[model samples]
Target: MSGTPDGQGLAPRTTPPSITQRHTALGIEGPGAPLADYRAAFQAARLAMAVVNRDGLVLDANPALGALLGTDPARLADRSAADLAGLREDPAQWAAYLAVLRGERPRMRCTRPLPPVAGAPRWAEISVERTADGRGVLLCLTDVTERADLQARLRHLEMHDPVTRLPNRSLFFERLAGALEQAGRARGGARIGLCYLDLDGFKAVNDTLGHRVGDRLLGAVAGRLTECAAPGGHLVARLGGDEFALLVEDSRGTDQLCELAERVLAALQRPFDLGGQRMSLSASIGLVERPAAETHATWLMQAADTTLYWAKADGRARWTLFDPERNAHRMTRQALSSTLRPALERGEFVLDYQPLVGLVDGVVHGVEALVRWQHPQFGRLSPNRFISLAEENGAIVPLGRWVLEAACRQGRRWQLAHPANPLVVSVNVAVRQVWDSDLVADVAAILARTGLPPRLLQLELTESAVMGSAGRPLEALQQLSDMGVAIAIDDFGTGYSNLAYLSRLPVSTLKLDGSFVRGFRAGEQPNPADQTIVEALVELAHRLGLTVTAECVESAEQADRLARIGCDTGQGWFYSRPVSADRVSALVGGYAPAPAVGSG
Candidate 1:
């Protein structure tokens, strides 16, 4: 009485009267006692209702029931309910109807296509209830076609990325898991592949161009990726941001994945016209393939991400295959990066000094401070292994500050120990240390704390870093230089040179890149080109009033040539390799004449 009979698969609503209830409510316990009132009430009902005998034949019908079935009320009479509902053809469906007809099941409910009558084939939930008298069953039909359509529409929206209309990360993983399960149950092992791609320099697009343009670019990229994927029947999805993924089921092997990745890259190479502005972009892809049984969706994605990283790191716009060995190395590198801050706090980092020798006299004039990690497990580790990592994560600021303080402390100690001849300590400063941090403040604080004159501290930055600097970064450098902290462009001539701009900066020294110094061979005639370039560079520096320091002077001949070329100083293995503070004292000891190094 509370809900429509047999409402199991249908929404609940007030029940239509049972045949016996109809008779009783109409006050007609006997045949022919009938009722205009009973007919009117039944006809006015909103739900489609009917009465069916135990033989599954319709005994009576309301106007709503007649209209729903697309039959006249007279035509509905004595018609088999199973036939009218389109269930007579299927034995299983008919049997379900028979249960309620025989009073075995109090109610029966099902959603199915009714016999074609009018417009489209209408789908409905058919509910049947056995009468208390066990003579017939009452039926109510509810149309659910529109509801089903609404649900389908909602499901489509939920599983797709709004921007690109591609399967979102959620649906991608779901399909991947399902594919893996299918592959696991197959006789011949099926392989699956995932190609993870990220747009290179996407952030720059967002920063320089508006996000509206960035979004348009992403849409364009997604379209290209979709075209590449369509040929191979691969599924492409946007995994958020500028990252997208391709899922290839039953993949042949790495060759197929490689081809797909190459196609994707090629597709992206074409310039995009975003609102009439032409832009060229490239993507870095990570290709990973394996037996489906051997990997899950999560790990597959992880491996793909790792491979993609190497592709970007190896210089972007290319695809990199997943290599376990490379992954192991990355894991180690990640572990090291994680421990760097803690290592600094634990005093696990120490400075080693390599003398910046006077090339002409071979005298140890100054020491370039090299920071080394006295890693607990790995022993002494060189800066090459972790310096770039530090720069990437902005850890270089603190790490460089610590190195500056330590080097200055040593420089002060050297000045004290040998008042007649003091040593200058050149500490390498990362670009991030200059741009992202307060270098002037840090240097001033450390210089004052260590009692080391600012002139004794030479801050070395890469040629690229100095050349790229502008605005606040250049202003910060000027401030430090004004404070008497000497600024040297290390590895000069390695980057795009801007001598005109370089002359305007407060740069005090030019350290020739190791490549140029290595070009000067020992025990052989110096290459004329190398000599010309070095001489030219040295002359240019001298004209700018900047001292020239040649790096990587590995042989006496190389050193002699540099000094002869009027290079003011040199630092390399030809000098002492980076040594401890104790060794620094030993190297600088007993140098005659002026031992005192002055502030800038």
Candidate 2:
């Protein structure tokens, strides 16, 4: 022992040996032998281990513990475990550790972060178990930082899309479901919306420019979308292959959704430059906004998908809002379209003719043959209900052929019945029949097969159809006209008043559109402007050596005005609504022709 009172000490001061060394100094007796064996085992163990007294102080530690802490075993002794592990830096963590050491917890386990012993900070799973001998607590620490980091990376990859790094379909659906659940709790007035967008003509890019350029385009699009403003905690996701979706939670209303859609569309308007190629792109968006409580995620997505199809159909690069009523009507139209081909095969269609009377003498000069669908379910559907459908599905080619054959056959029947006065039959021709079909060949075949003279067959085309004609369409019309068939422009005055083309085409007559005819009523004063336009049109037709036919003359006043204006032929309810072939025969049989303005 050393003492410092006023002079020199009996022996120089020296640090005492550690507890384990002191235990070795004493002989291995009854209880001391087990303690000595435990000391040897603790020193030989590979994992980090420590013994902590009730005060949270480290009473002893092994070599592994010293290595884990980046300090020597002697330096670790008598230091608090919390201090060595760095938990004492946080007051709440320190308090929780103290509580576990006070016997308040049966067995405590936690993950603690330690200061940077290496370049990066480390993590350890620290577990405390009460010693069986009731001396103190034994601490066990396992390094799990690498595993935790790997798990985090795996989670990120699972939730995000690889191409755009946006939320994947699964994660988008998950967040959508969560938003719906939150909306359900709002009781009422909680609106949510979704904008489903598809890049228009995107496949053409991949086909012509290669998929790599397409991929670059998609990435540029994604970057722009991410930069777009998304209100109310909205999120954007890539739904695979040129499709993307935006989820707007707590949407204000349809106005907000529309605004978002507009913004999205506007974003795509800017041209994209990739691989030194400047390309312009547009998108079609389907917007669906509704009470989240009343709709599920699947239903909302379905509505958006259905509406997106509509947007594409109506013409790409537009937005379409979901309308239940409009959708129902479209469904009905689809059903009707599905049944049309079979109806044609079953011979469920019939021809109805309306007389074109001479305005000078009220005698039937010609008749217009209009197709009627004698649908078994719908009874009798007009061409208005199904003609556009046939055109859209490419069925118009076959359907138009059938009409031509039937009308020509009927014209032959009329010619045979009235050998003295044969009447011309005007058949409406669809734009698709003119452009997508071998119209000249079809008409020639029908005319020869039915043995009907070409001069007696008039094909009526809409003004817009004829006005837009060029290249193949113009050549086709010229061929048909050269075959002695009469070509007439129907629905005149409603479309491009292209007078220059009128003289250049093979057209022989102009059937002024019904809208203009309806303007000049029988008893009322005609609209001066309409009257002037009609007068000017009739004069123009005459100067061009083309007959002028006024359609939809509903009263004597209209007929007289039409006759006064030198319209050679007039047809409408005033003459009679569309009638059967027998009615046309009767009208033609009991009529007389007289000289009118240019009829002579």
Candidate 3:
């Protein structure tokens, strides 16, 4: 299908055998065959053929050949094709024709003109072969004009996308590789610039405009992108989906990269005209400019990728370049988050419990479950170090489940060991885990699997995690609460909350924001205002019939103030640090009521 011999064209076309005899003037040898058989076969075969004398005189022609010449075979015979072919440029067909006749050279193909019947003179591939018996020559011709056109189309499809007609990933990588290779060979080895672009809200376009319009917008975008390239040294490629990559070669300076980037940003700032609708969007660009020396494609691409994420994080329509110091910190966080799940299976992650003690009774109440990762590379990482990343990357689904099961198992063990205290365990829930996963089912499964009583497990959710989760999430929360598992609002007051939402939301406990408690001792004097604020929060919570737990009670003075304010429970370093289960047991049994506590 691909490797075709010279003078053979696969595109469907017609050529006059008389036109072929014109090229026989170029010293090409033809096959020996009777004029009748050759004539019949030439007309029947796709290839055009004509019989000619050594002098390039047309002796006989087929009907098919006449059609290609825009004339009849009877009219073409007895005519000198060489003199007629000379009317076209490069008219040396006869010189080569004489060489074959003199046995000075082998048969060959030559380009000759066949004056058009309609538009213009057409180009034909002509082959003249020597007869085995050494009589007159047989000339074969194929119209290669159409073939050349088709080859152009095939190359376009291979390098460019059919839909947007933009350079696809393949072509982009090809150009990128070439740029890097060239950069490496240079004196200073200039840097290659990468612009990783992603549409900010293209999904909204598909949803609103329909895919047809979305496709048109992409095509128009492709056109605009092509206009952003530096004169002759840049390539833009669509890396599939809504992502695009730009490779700027000879980008000796960052100034060129910045200029092109700004141009792209300005172009996208204008609204696109799609049919009657005017639409607009922005792109987040990640940039990494690396020298060609000893650099691999993977590192360049990854640097660009990291920078692009910064763009998304800092809000779109902006570009961020890779920084070694910043990327190293990010890499460390990524390494730890990646190891989170596998760490669970390997027993490298464990839970530490901080007791939520009862103020009135001055006894151990429940324990807040805190997770820790003893990473081999990172040593030990607190939840704050890697939690947000886990939630963003969907690692929380696995992490939350691990915490739930582990706490449930430990809670069940402690309840049996210390039946009177019967400490409850609370596990924090991430928004992603709450929205995308069946938290109730997971909780039920963990409880059933761990054989922990429903009353001894508590689920803690942030206010924002519950704000938008109305229908099914509310239903799930109610179902779990009804099963006697307690639900608490963690980090209260850090997020927006309404009294109505507080009453409507299915919850049993409100953990006071640590900020307020931490703010206590920093006051100029004994701030009655602080006392009044804590009392008001407790009164409001008590009105909703929700138990209030004051967090960060670091001193006996703060504990006394919180307790006097009717704060039902408290947990902080004032009692004991989050510690091992054995340590928790010893401390809880030996816990003596502290006079008061304060932390700011």
Candidate 4:
């Protein structure tokens, strides 16, 4: 009667007759008529009207009822009311239908389902009345199930994710409270275990394939999740934007909880065959198994959320359980993030330069400018300690600008000191540092402020930072390269390895990851495996006309192997660890070492 019936499977409204219209519609010649006459009038009304005996047997049914029940009037009288109507399928539906019959004495309207007149289901509004004569009751049923069902469906849609069709935030909490009580009465359980999962890299798919495809992918994921819970009575819910939660019953220990987490991880390993895009993404699950000591759903959810943050922070596509030490780390992270904005304002960030030596020449050809924080309270903090926190809290944008300026200024300083043996300063760029901020403007500003020659500044970005760049990021990188600022893909081979896309990026160098470089020293002699990997990487870069710099070169033997394998430059303790600007400057100014060339 109030809201529009959304076009879901539901009933439509039946027009009720006005007082004067009711007399005309039903043709009631009332005045002093016996109650049987009044009962007969109700039974004869245009709407489907019926009266049933208390034992739930059909006593009377009218012509309109025949249309609703998919039967002729002659056959309708022979069938039981519940059988012909849809009440036979669901017991609850049948019970509600019977409550309207017998002694019920008033106008009541409801969209009760009925068997099809043709092949379609009938939604009917059933109203009943008690006669004064008390001989029998007269019932009125008008079909409005369509409108009612639509209303119910609309309510469901409001509280559920369309992709997952699962209970969302509001509905999840509502169900969780009930589950907690049932879990509270467990035979010998300690506490409940809640696993929260957020898919890593889902946004890139959304951006690349558009929201329509993204929604379909989410639906596919939801189907898999429902199957994941089919084995056990776990309650899985979608908490929006690729985040899902599972509430496991009778979960007591970390082992039990982790078992479910592993199932989730394995289930997701299957490819999502999302149309043509053979996308393979993974999730980070955070586990918090409640102890007997804990209380309340709020605290339980907080534990799950905290653990989930660690999963993403430690590394994505993995799971981490809540531990006391993890809590300490989280608190420390929050404290650090709180100060980042103010730190930028107070100029608390500084740059330290580590030399990137040419492995063949044994010369410091470039210095990677690394950001460090001299926190007022936390003492000195490395970027590893606080950079991720800064990125998560949106402080990376301004903080990154400061680092770019400081690194460029330092490179300009070293360039002025040694004009002949000029050096390039490489700076690590965070993913967030490029998403919203204008890379070209930021680099141009730094170069302008520091008066650093364009070649002196080398921007180092990770593979994840560049793989998804298409529009603005692509254009920005091109602008910076055109402006003479060199770009290098830092941490090569450690990200979404779309090799077909690598050559198209506007960059001049690739830094072989330290992991592969360190593998060289794993055996008694230079690891032939590591040596071979380096050679392959060097050849790839050489073919692309991009210089290769192998990282973490520690010994002369290692350096010799790298150079023989075609590595032109290397950065490690062998060249120098990240050092003070003054120390780096001195080394760059008067250093002389012959280029190491020749087959090993």
Candidate 5:
């Protein structure tokens, strides 16, 4: 009897026991006594068993062992037990078996694959233990082939998608993580690439043709994608809905990824015929490939998602590559949008005034109140960086109210300082301010708080926002105008250019867009078309009782050209760039006596 490593055994022996004594000590008894009972028990045992000497040579094997090996019991004698049990194929297990035979280890157990016998390969768990005499070892083998096959089937079902019969998102992510980790350990600049794809207008197909057809279309698309990716042996996965991803491990470079994307796009465009309901569809792909050492799974997927949006935005049936600079800009925009509401409360906003000088008199009559963000982390940012973002996120309502209140306060201060010639303060208003907020009440409240007359406060809106105003917006504009607040259309000629419709609305002034003003050349070869257009616009505005202002007047030459064309006021760098409040005050103080309101 062999003892386990835990210092326990069936029987203790001070000296080596004979075969009969060993059998009798194990409680085997019958009519034939020890040897006959031992032989009967060994042959009748269900588990395959063999006895080997210290040299690993099999001294004897039971009929059960012969049946497992597909051979005769006598033939197993004189054969190497390690070889018969397939332990010699694995060096570690062979070494462990040798250690057990040398009495260094009490026992050792391991699983190994057996060579084909009778055209049937088998896997078995083999156990080797030292005998009670410490002169030989007993080997036992157990078949586990069925268990291995069952586990493999379960793994396949777990990792694959049922619809497209491809890998699902779970397996895709697993493979991506593994590829990234392996690439990190690989040498020679190995990289990973991903093409994140989404079928364009796939929802419409489901809406009209039903989901069954949509599913079939998806299956066809998956087949095409697999065929396209087959050349590079990439992994194609269906990531829910119409979205799919192709993963390239050990990618060559951007060129390879781009080529694969182009191939996939071409393949998907060839009209998917789903049970005679033929339809043509396209896909947008976002491609990202980088050195695996520099990125991980989450960041890579995010980049791919963003790039896919770019592809759709740039028009579908195309692929866009990941751009770091663009990604940084988008990240900055998101950060600004998320922090905008809190930033207003933090007092990070301030106003800078640009002198809206009168083109005819060359006097500073008004100043446009431009808002600036004094961010703690990003420093100062101008309106172009965040105005639209604020509007989209609904932060503009509060931010706009703050700007109006602050500008009015400053306007009242200037009125007190220069009652003889008070400068009108102009502020830009986004369309959302009217629809999303109580513009009428907000303006009235700010006017009362700051004691700034509506006559000295002018509100500027883009032409597109004010042109087609109706419903609440139109009524709001009419009320603001009736309250004695001047309403001017900023960027006048850019949008809807409905000059004739201006007469039907309560508009007071037109601030020509910078593009039209930039067209006013000064040299010998001036742009005649631009000069004629500006002259006609100014004349028409004056006739309609609306003041005309020229924007982006950079040089004295351009200012002279605008003034000669009957433009009433000019706002540009020729007079001054947007400056601090203190700077605007100094300029106003140095000005000569002028009218209270020179022009719009």
Candidate 6:
């Protein structure tokens, strides 16, 4: 050992002192022979090791350390240990190394890149820990180049699609997340866009041809998409199967996205010659572009997906840009449809009745029961809002059942209150209800439970549903009619106006559609065509023993014309807008005859 000017020991030893000797020198006790074995093992070990003072200068280095750095063991002394492991190049790691050297930290570990050596690793994991003696720190340098390279290769394989050699969904989403974060912090109106594409009739190709051919086609499509995206340097990714997406970061606007979508569509239109098998194909693209700060990954992807479906639905082979209004409507419909069944069970549905007054007597002849949905989230929803959605999702059957029962119960209450003038309750029925449910049985059950006479209950169906009656529908209607329930054709002449066919069926009345009544103008320039049509329909209905009910009678003039045409009963705003059950009862209680029509 040699003494330095600062009174610290600086030594170059043939064999480094054992830990026991070092501890003993520091006034600690340990067995000597085992520590001697530890000292020898440190010198002969494969791991590179060094002992450095508090200043980060190497006091001593093992043979393994010298071999790793490609220098002699003696030359490593007095050298900066951080410089040896290349940690000095990184400020964070350099600070950490200094902290450990100054005894401020227990240990620090980091991986750093080293200058390439002919037969040595180019990366090292440097770990610095304070020695037990507290006089110095121990540094270990591990060669991690092999592990680093393995991890890099594995990451590459995981982030890329095996077939198209493009980034896979995992990597695409990762990049999208990063981009969104950056965009959120960016200034100005930085935006992002995505084009979600699916090959039309791809399944057909996979079915007719082998999957091998299908995969080849996908590869070809990916190549074309990559070429199209190359001009903008957009990232193209394969999102499984035949679906691909192009992510445009820092997008200019929707125009840029739309232009890219059009280019992709045009590119996919060309014929492909795959292994002597020729085929032509088209693609449908859904494009979404918005300010990156305003949207997230899931919402942006949903918009793109919905737009793509719209492209397909609007006859395919095209591109559709995201429309906020259309998307809102679709989302609302979805929300209503999903909640419809539960809403019925939750008793969120109620009925409002509109009085259908007699054109001759102006008496409150009957009331049309209209279903209203008192949705908690969306507030009150009229039938036009969710009825079609309910029909599509098969919720109409249960909902229709509810409407029938509720209407019947209310109609029975009115009948018991005023037996002398019991009003019929007419309920609108969806075509799906007729097919999907036992309509006749449901109506019978509802009437029987409510004690409402079948004569006081009428079921209104569209002409299309009633005209071509056959099989179950015809049988259901005939049975209900035989049970004394009146079957009236709602929206007459709007659908198949097979008037001759109505006589052969068990129909009792024809409620002409509001469109025909809308055509009946009140001025001197009255629509003669509309009047003639109504008159002829009324004459034919009266001759066939079917009552003619004109709908949408908004004014007394229109009502007078309808009554003069020999129309039986009328339903419209002229009588009243659809009102609550209490309001309908008030109208029924205060009935009066319509004023006589003068010959004009």
What TM-score against the true fold does each predicted structure earn?
0.64, 0.63, 0.64, 0.51, 0.86, 0.85
> Candidates' lDDT values, in order?
0.83, 0.84, 0.76, 0.74, 0.86, 0.87
Itemize residue pairs with steric clashes in candidate 5. none
Candidate 3: stretches off by over 4 Å: 1-157, 161-168, 198-227, 230-233, 237-245, 271-282, 323-341, 358-362, 385-402, 412-422, 429-457, 465-484, 501-506, 522-531, 543-545, 597-600
For candidate 4, write residues 1-600 as lDDT tens digits. Answer: 122112123233375323333233233336663556655675577888665433333445667776665556545432344554445466665455555544453333344666555565557765545444444345566778678778778889987887778878888887777767665666345567788999888999889889998888888888888888878778888988999998775665789778888888888877888767677879999998775334678977888888888899988888998897868887888889898999889988888888887676567788888888998888989989988888899898888888888888877877788888888888888877778688788888778888999988888888888887898788888898999988998888888867777689987998888887776662457566766767877898899898988888776666777777888788888767888899887788554343456664
Q: Candidate 6 has which clashing residue pairs, if any? A: none
Model 4, C-alpha of 580: deviation from truth (Å): 1.0
lDDT of 5: 0.86
Q: In terms of TM-score, which candidate is strongest?
A: 5
Q: How would you order the candidates by lDDT, starting with the best?
A: 6, 5, 2, 1, 3, 4
How well is each residue in 1-600 modelled by candidate 6, as lDDT tens digits? 443322245555777665455545433346443656666777888999987766666767889988877789778776667668877678898778777766789999998887787755478888999878677788899888899888878999999999999999999999999999998887568899999999999999889897999999999999999999999999999999989999999999988998998899888998998988889999999999999999999999999999999999999999999999999999988999899999999999999998888888899989999999999988998999999999999999999999999999999999988888899999999889989989988998888899999999999999998888889898998999999999999999889898778778899999999888877666745677877887889899989999988899887878887887888888888888889998888877566447467786
Per-prediction backbone clash count:
6, 0, 24, 10, 0, 0
Candidate 1 lDDT, tens digit per residue, 1-600? 221222223333355445666455424456775566667777899888987656565657888887887768756755567767776666777777777766677887888776555555567888888766676678888888787667767988998988889999999989999999998788468899999999999999999998989988898999999999998899999999999999999999999999999999899999999878999999999999999998888899889989998999999999999999989888878988999998999999998888887765656778899999999887889999899889887788889999999889989999999887788889999888877788888999998899999888899988888886889889998998989989999889889787886788899999998988887786677678878988998999999899999888777667767777889888877666778999779867553121123221
TM-score of 1: 0.64
Give the range where candidate 3 is weakest over 10 consecutive residues by summed lDDT: 1-10
Candidate 5 lDDT, 1-600, residue by residue in tens? 354322223243466555455344433434555577568878899999987766676667888889888899877765778778877677898788878977899999998887666776678889998877677778999887787667767888888888899999999999999998887777558899999999999999999989988888989999999999998899999999999999999889999999999999899899877777778999999999999889999999999999999999999999999999999999999999999999999999999999988776778889999999999999999999999999999999999999999999999999998888899999999999999999999999999999999999999999999989889988998999999999999998889998666997888999999998777665644688987998999999999999988899887667777777888998888778899888888777455222232232
**How much is the lDDT of residue 244 in candidate 3?**
86
Clashing pairs in 1: 420-595, 420-596, 421-595, 421-596, 422-595, 455-600
Q: In candidate 5, how many Å is residue 554 off?
A: 1.2
**Preferred candidate (lDDT higher): 1 or 3:** 1
Worst 10 residues of 6 by lDDT: 1-10
